[model samples]
Target chain A: NAGVTQTPKFRILKIGQSMTLQCTQDMNHNYMYWYRQDPGMGLKLIYYSVGAGITDKGEVPNGYNVSRSTTEDFPLRLELAAPSQTSVYFCASSYRAGGPDTQYFGPGTRLTVL
Target chain B: DQQVKQNSPSLSVQEGRISILNCDYTNSMFDYFLWYKKYPAEGPTFLISISSIKDKNEDGRFTVFLNKSAKHLSLHIVPSQPGDSAVYFCAATRVFDMRFGAGTRLTVKP
Candidate 1:
């Protein structure tokens, strides 16, 4: 299985611009998450979905939005980009809730907001 | 506030030596702890994990020790190899909420 896959390995966006980071998983995981890692900082959860049509905010959800329309896809949207949004974003999935042991991560997408 | 923290930013060890990475969490809600290894240009991969119930968990050359009282955990790699050089992240999770540490770069010199 491909496990988890994220699109746009690298991207640069101007201030006030918008873009979507696409994520897909072939593992049919019930839980999916979006996290961003800044330089010298740990991964901060932007959003998470326990299943399709159920999304919730996380530690750093400002300027970010997410939609889980299908079991395989969980996309993150940035309405208005800002310099503070520059970071490496990662998508991950797990077979079930509370089972991080089965978590699989995507390569990551590096975003630069200028 | 940073819930999970890896105090050491980097660590260097000679090949075949033992490399230990430490992590501490400020939240007591974290029951499951994990260690992930990340190579350059790649995503982090699961290395090992320990639950709060068990004090330790071992998998091959990797071992995880958890101290619930101190809200601390550690990963020990024995006989480290050059290929083992990478950034190690400590993660703690409760149910669906997971937090990661800043990461500690481990360099295994040959």
Candidate 2:
């Protein structure tokens, strides 16, 4: 299983430009999440989905949007990139809810908003 | 407000010594705690985890101790090796909401 996979390992975006970060998992996980980690900062949740066609905002979802079109895909959308959006974005998935079940993370996408 | 925090930004330890990383959380709702290890260009990987009912969990050379009363948890790596040198993140979750600490960079010097 590939676990979780994120596309475009790295990218540079100008202010106001929009892009989508793609994520897909073959584990058939019921939960998927998008988190951004700034230098020296912990991962902040931007969005999460419990299943197909269901999405929810997280703590840092202000400039982000997410759509879960299939059980294996959850993509994050940046409507208009900002300098603050520059960070390492990770896509993670978990088999089930609750503690003890570890979340598998993808390699991460490093984005720079210039 | 940061619900989960790793006070120490970095820690240095002699090779073959013990390295302990600490984490604290303010939310009592967190029922599960986890530790993740990450290298320079890679995503974080799950190292270990502990449930609320258990006070401690051990996985090979790594052990996790949880203090529910203090809302604190710790990860101890015995006989630390250079391979263990990386950023360690402490994470907590309640059902679906998983929160992470700022992370502690552990340097195991040879």
Candidate 3:
């Protein structure tokens, strides 16, 4: 089974442009997350959802938005992309919270904003 | 402010040697800690983890140690192999949030 799948493995956008990064999981997980990794930095949380229809902002959610319309998909939206938004984006999911549930991550999407 | 920190930016070790990576956190409320390894062009993969109540947990060749009083944790890889080369991330869980520290690059040379 495809654990977690992300589309458009790489994308380049111009300033002020908008795009969506798609992520889906077949694990039937209840928790989903979006993170961005900058060079030499840890992955920073952009947004997360506990389940479908519920979402919350994470540490670095300024330029991003997310929606969990269904349990299997959580897509990240970038509106008016900025240079600061150029980074490797990762989508992860877990069955539940706390202790070794193992958040399965997708291959990642590399986005560049000029 | 960064709640979690991985001080070493990079480390190199000969194959078959022991490789130790350290992580420190400023928050004492973290109940769970984890180590994830990431290959180039790939997302971080879960390696090992430990809980506040346990000082140590081992899985295969990887071991994670937690020192609650010091707010410190470590991942030790015994008989490190060339395949272990990657960027390693340390993460901590607090309530409903999870925080990740700057990663450490580990290279095992043959």
Candidate 4:
């Protein structure tokens, strides 16, 4: 089912530059999330969407923005890139939340902010 | 502050040996726990999971044990193979919030 897919496998950005990390899932999941993983650190939530037109901030959402225009897509935007944002980004989806449901993750995007 | 923690940064074992990875959580209300495996340059994939209601869950060569009293859980891979080498993450979730551990790299040398 293609599961989840992310675009721009790798990218480099200059300070203050902005870009969107695209994520799409064919599983028709109702919940989607964006997370960042730093070296030797666990994945930290950036933002999440419950469904189309419904979004919420996560633990580490300060420097990122997200929009859920449709059920299949949830794009994460970095408004002002900073060196601290250099890390691996992952998009995940699940049929539902707060239960036994498993979250399916994308291949991940490697971003380097210079 | 990190709610979930995997104290071991890495673990090594010989092929066909047992590999045990441990995890501890500070929140006592966590109702579900999960384990994920990740290869270099790839996102994590689900390995196994256990709910608070149960103390142990087993699937094939993998097993997960939860100790509610201690607020700790562990994953055990029996007869580990070289292909099992990867980073393992421990995760815990309550109603809407989920937290992950730093991850433990497992190397099963053949």
User: Per-prediction fnat values?
Assistant: 0.63, 0.85, 0.63, 0.63
Sort all candidates by DockQ, best to worst: 2, 4, 1, 3
What are the per-residue Cα lDDT tens digits for candidate 1 across A1-114? 788999999999999999999999998788899999999998888999999999999899999989988999999999999999999999998887664474789999999999
Better of 1 and 3 by DockQ: 1
lDDT of 2 by residue, B1-110 (tens): 99999999999999999999999999998889999999999899999999988999998999999999999999999989999999999999997688899999999999
Tens digits of per-residue lDDT for model 3, A1-114: 989999989999999999999999999999999999988788888999999999999899998889899999999999899999999999999988767667899999999999
Chain B TM-score of candidate 4 stands at: 0.98
The better candidate by DockQ, 1 or 4, is 4
Candidate 4 TM-score over all chains jointly: 0.98
* Model 2: colliding residue pairs: none
lDDT (tens digit, per residue) of candidate 4 on A1-114: 899999999999999999999999999999999999999999998998899999998899998989999999999999999999999999999998866677899999999999
For all candidates listed, what's the TM-score of chain B alone? 0.98, 0.98, 0.97, 0.98
> What are the RMSD figures for all models against the true structure?
0.9, 1.0, 0.9, 0.7
Query: Please, what is the whole-model Cα lDDT of each candidate in the order they appear?
Result: 0.92, 0.93, 0.92, 0.94
lDDT computed for candidate 3: 0.92
Give the better candidate number (3 or 4) by TM-score: 4
Residue A43 displacement in candidate 3 (angstroms): 0.7
Q: Which ten residues in a row have the lowest lDDT in candidate 4 chain A?
A: A94-103
Lowest lDDT 10-mer window, candidate 4 chain B? B91-100
